[model samples]
Target: MASGTSQAPEDGGVMPSRAPELLSGNPDVTPDAIRATEKKKVEAPYGQWKSDITKEALFRGSRKLLSPRVCSRTGRTFFTEARPDGIYHLVEASQSGATYSCHTVLPEGYSARSRVYEYGGGADDGKGDDGDAGPRVIFCNFSDCTVQILDVDTEKVTCLLAESDTLRYADFAAPPRPGSPWVLAVQEDHASAVPDQVRNYVVVIHTATGEVRRAVEGADFYMYPSFSADGGKIAWVQWDFPDMPWSGVKLYWADWNDEDGAVSNVEWVAGEDGMTVTEPRWGADGFLYFCYEKTNYRQFYRRRPGGDMALLDLKRYEEAEFGSASMFIGSHTYAILSKECIVAVATENGSDKVIAFNPETLQSQDLSLPLSEITYDGLYRLSDTSFIVIGGGDTTPQAFYLVDITDNDDGARDNRKLTNIRWSIDEVLNPEIFSTPQHIHFSAKSGPKREIHGFYWPPHNLEYKGPEGTKPPLIVQSHGGPTGHTGPGLALSMQYWNARGYATFAINYSGSDGHGKTYRELLNGRWGAIDVNDIAESVRHLSSSTSTPPLIDGRRVGIRGGSAGGYSVLQALCQHPALFAGGACYYGISDVKLLLQETHKMESHYVDFLLFTPGMTDADKEQVMRDRSPVHHAGNITAPLLICHGEDDKVVPISQAYTMYDDIRARGGEVKLVKFPGEGHGFRKGGELAQGA
Candidate 1:
């Protein structure tokens, strides 16, 4: 990797000073009044915020925060940390059972390839510094895989799969494929594959020969490949264009043709089966276990060849959403971490039970960590026993952890941190006054089993406790993805707001992940309904109880969100105009009908899944689209709203914001429109949009 010290001055741009500070509460809203209202909101059956604050507190604690340049895996003793120096360093400790070492591998002339995407490699150890033994990596540069590999000895580029779009490390093809080691790479080409040729082929590369072999091709798109135990085959999931990977996809497999030195006999494994198979893996015995969503809930399942897919262990709860956790990568099974017998990350029934199952014994265990809330990403296994986990929940930033399975039998254990991820954010956060979040859940309606989950942070002061006991105002936040879940990860944003004296409520609405497929699908065909209720329930929770965070003047509540969250914000304003006093939306979907027509090729048909319509006809599409569109109902939105968009946005066109602004203004609604040229669905050109948005 080229030295990044020279480039740090340019890439490490200084933070801006004019950032908008978070408001603690309404200026006129007294602390005493807030305390009184809290009790009322809690006593009122409709108020859910009080319980939310209490629950938020349940999931709070210190978390690891690291730089964005690196990624970590579970089960690995050490984690990979990408430095501003343009190098990825492998750090491990013996207590975790993985050795630590740094390798400098970069291709020549790369002159500092952007560290946009880099993932760490687990120890294969004997391979040597030059891609022989040490750590391996799988990363992607927006242009290609060039940013992923660098020569440890020379810090020079060693392996660059320029032809491949992205690369990710999977459990070594079990038993190790002979001749050359194999890793999966998702590649795209305009030609070659048939049926549908949008993204082309899935390539399996031979590390020794630099030979790239096509495994499977011809689909709208595919990602997340896993190797079957025998090393003779591969299993992966595929979904077509316009459909988000989570909505629905098909699982597939292919046999290796040793003589041909490539993949042959490609076919979908139970292709038409009505199941959403995610995180597929093959156990040592060759049984395929994967998480599947059916009947509105996501559950893990195992399948033996020629046998039916059977559910392993699962939780069916209408009150508590399950399957909200996302598995960035998967292995055959998770190693036990704490003596508590929890799965560490994948818990069953909220208990930390050691799940040793029959070939069909599906057991679940919950591993409660020090933090009350958490959001984890990538998983890695080290020496096939220990585990390393990445990504932290709300209070924690992306940190790497080392868990020794051997210690699980004893109740006394402390998972060691290989690096201090918190160091990165400590300078920015005021530790003394940081407020912890409380977790809470509430029923969506009068008697439905469905519920919403969220964490609420109450206002705090450095010196003054309160003026004879006062409560703080609150900001209800609806998370992005409309499909994504709200994990217990700490955010500078949340702390910044809390320090300023405002309480913030961030909720995982009905369709959010963690609660399984059924809850995940609640938003489907009912996007406007469930999402709206989830937010309202949060407000009710806050306004009614002293046990919860204090509420500001009911007339002064405000809301802000981006993308799907932005859509929710717009929806809230239209459906409950008096609920939020002000709203800010960033790249939110403004028009359901327009989004269906103008979305990127990768997600062109996604609206069909959410809106519950084929979207095949103009009239049918228009009706459903109009029903959910906030823009269509803008005339009724009385709250003042700030709209921000990227000029080049394709996910949700910039025009969506413009059209809404024009219409709202035409109808005498307060609105602000901000536009950035040469931008896309997301902001990339620094804080320009952040400043305006």
Candidate 2:
């Protein structure tokens, strides 16, 4: 053979070219031929395609962590992170290299959660420094409903109150100074026979001796008990039955005699005549600040020591809500940073923003928040110009950010200084696969000039494209609290559908929160009728719109929701049978009358506002309840329905689902019911969620 040259074939045939040898594949297969074959494989259709956002993704140990609390003594921030194990861990934030490190503060199996009112809050609060011993923390344990103290120095957890399953405590508040040596909490007694007679009061627990004693009583319900900076005064909100906390509440304050350990000179300051008052905070200067809904909106108000209440002037800004309806125990909208400055979270058009206000000057400036949605009770003031908040945008699920407002010029410019220190998930998902929400406003036929709002999210899949010219199926989600508004935050469950080529729409119907008082009250005395109409109208508006993408199929729509939203789902499918292809109801109410009689004490009187008319007789109310119940009108439903209920649910009993299932099946309608054994109103167990998904 010649050096650096090709050799002759052994068979005496012409030698092949060097291209096939370099390619090193089938000799006859050219590069162009291989490329064509791969292209055909990419375009070929197999069976139905699956996505990475599978049921496992939906049931995975992902969580939406919130409630950031920074310790003044240690300068370390602590927050609760909920996980698929159905437990919440008190996490301490630290830094490692360029990444954040989360250290679990609580011991294994010790969940820092409260079951008060079944919506749990006020479970954790930072205790001020005890002399030179650093700051302590008081938290409620879900295991035994006992209040516990976490000693920062020792890293030891000790029960501040003896463990008792019958007695539950939440909404913790520590005195500003260690002289009191006690923590204030709301105590809920579950041993009472009469639901109305259950004892709920503000109590004080001795930090050292673990002794608990009543601090304030004489009210049907008490929540958010807060001590003044001097520890010489205390304030809280109370409400009676036939009225929810959001419907009406009285703000009361009393002079505290710390030496004698008594409350005296108590007086009802505000909240009368079905007015809602919440988040009563005492400023450093002794003025009591709170959110009051006297007008159509819940606005920020401050009352001087002996003067009347006045609204903080925010007329220059667009009309918005300063506070959320008191649905849970620790729902806070604003935090008083100093006597003159306050940081508040407000909602407008289904989005939330942080604002800094000068209570004295009545001047306000919007803080440039990176996220469109701020979690309730997420704002914590670290200083006059700095704070920490838990929020999420269209792509970020939920994360903690240190926000600085020192540069805010009180103008329209983006003055927010933000730094992300921690995330809810360990690994960040691809943002391209997440669907961003588009705010849509549509008019409803039933309400005439009334407009309905919703967040419309189109399907997004970076790797997959649906069959050409085929529209995606639509899923209309009804939020749990008909009073709850669906904000424009990234939701993994919503993204799961979007990634799988399904469009999702979350409706803030007539009765949803965040749209001011008038909108929230739209479902009053017309719950089933108005909510159903608004949901149907939202679907109809999207289906008939010319701007809708061809990828959205008008005729293929489904509805799903839990609790109040589930009720709306069932009602909408029953009333507008031809509008939906299927529906999913989770722990939904099928009988309003039964719900009124058998529901939990916290919501026992909720039906009075939903189904009752002032002048109607008992018979009339009963007839109306029956007429509005989906179980009674199962024959009207034509769409296939799936009903899932927690067997232990007390808010909307499993019986509600059972009755609806039987009624629809007896009517020869398409229906299926699934029950989760150890679940409640909401499924928290990992196995349960996996099974349900």
> Which candidate should be chosen as best, given lDDT against the real structure?
2
Q: Candidate 2: misplaced stretches above 4 Å?
A: 1-50, 95-99, 408-415, 466-469, 546-551
Query: 138 in model 2: Cα distance from truth in Å?
Result: 1.5
Give lDDT for model 1: 0.52
* RMSD (Å) per prediction: 9.3, 11.4
Cα lDDT tens digits for candidate 1, 1-693: 000111111222211211112112236558897566545432211112221112122122121222122212222233333342223333332222233322223333332212111111221121212323334444443323342454333443454454443332322222244333555655545332231333535676665565667677767655556556566777777766545556556777777654455776666664333446665656666666666665555555567666776765544322232222231322222432222232323432221112222333333333333333333333444433344445543333334443444334433323422332212221323233456666677666542468667777776534333233455667778777667765555665565566555678888888877666666777777787678878877787678763344454354577888888999999999988878888989889888777766664444565566776444577775677788898888877988999989887766789889888999999988899988786666554433433443
In terms of TM-score, how similar is model 1 to the real structure?
0.72
User: Model 1, residue 678: displacement in angstroms?
Assistant: 6.2
Deviation from native of the Cα of residue 202 in model 1, angstroms: 2.3
Model 2: per-residue Cα lDDT over 1-693, one tens digit each: 011122322211112222112212245558797556545432212123345655654555365566788776556777787766778887776645644546677778688888888788778998655777755789988877877788855779877677775799888887776656777789888797456666788887777787778978877788889888778888999988787877778899988776656778988888986788888888888888888888877788888668988878686544688865655787666777776678888889789888887788877877756578888868776776677788887766577776665543543425655767655543355554577799988667775457799898987665555565566789999997768889998888788788767889999988787888888888788889988888877777777754454435778999999999899988998899999999999899998888877777788778788778789998898799989998888899999999999988877888899889999999898999988887788877764588666
lDDT of each: 0.52, 0.76
- Candidate 2 global CA lDDT score: 0.76
